[model samples]
Target: MMEVIPKQFWEGVEQFNSGQFYACHDTLEALWMEASEPDKTFYQGVLQIAVGLYHFGNQNWRGAAILLGEGNNRLRRYPEVYSGIDVDELLDKSLTVLKTIQMAKPEELALLKLGEDENLPLPKIVRSA
Candidate 1:
């Protein structure tokens, strides 16, 4: 059977994809708090990415650029968490989106799609809810 991703992660991604940047930040931050050392590093990158996405959703190009840039740098330190989860590739696309937005170029933001499906990582609550 396919494993179910953590509810918090899915909730964060959903909030992010749905243009709820603050909610994404809040949800992902919860997950980030409970993560262990190595995993915490991973979640830190993810949180920054979420923050970037939040800024992007809010149309804050400068904020998005800065946070996404940080996220992109953090992404270089990690491998894909699993199949279909290429953190590096996603960061690259996000950076491109941020740069295009920063440059005020007419870019296709729709091309920078993150999955909407609910089937992803394990669904355990890392810390107390």
Candidate 2:
């Protein structure tokens, strides 16, 4: 069962889903700062994902690749559907983006489909009461 979602976390989710990666980073980072133990890892993972997207937005392929890889690794530790998030789907998307970058040569990175302006499909939060 899903627990009550915190206001800040919900806000972060909204920002993240709306492609406001920087805002998501800011919002989730605040939540992560006050979180503990397992939740801390969860929040950190989300925050890292946000920052990784932000880096992708800024055309920082290397930064995006590193952070996205690390973030997904942390998130994989959680249940497949923890806190209303479909971890499996999210992981798949992250992996797609990572592979796209990893497969490209530095100069050819611009030809990748996972660019900053790309309208990539993102995972949504399955909100629970």
Q: Which model scores highest in lDDT?
A: 2
Q: Across residues 3-50, which tens digit of lDDT does each residue of candidate 2 receive?
A: 665789889988988889899989988888988767888888888887
Q: Which pairs clash inside model 1?
A: 5-121, 5-123, 6-122, 6-123
Candidate 1 local lDDT, 3-110, one digit each (tens): 544677767766655667677778878877986655556566667867776666556667777887786787667665431255645665566555665665546443
Q: Residue 62, candidate 2: how far off, in angstroms?
A: 0.9
Clashes of each: 4, 0
Q: Which pairs of residues clash in candidate 2, taking residues 3 or more apart in a chain or in different chains?
A: none
What lDDT would each prediction earn against the true structure? 0.59, 0.77
Q: Where does candidate 2 stray beyond 4 Å?
A: 113-129
Residue 92, candidate 2: how far off, in angstroms? 0.8
The most accurate candidate by TM-score is 2
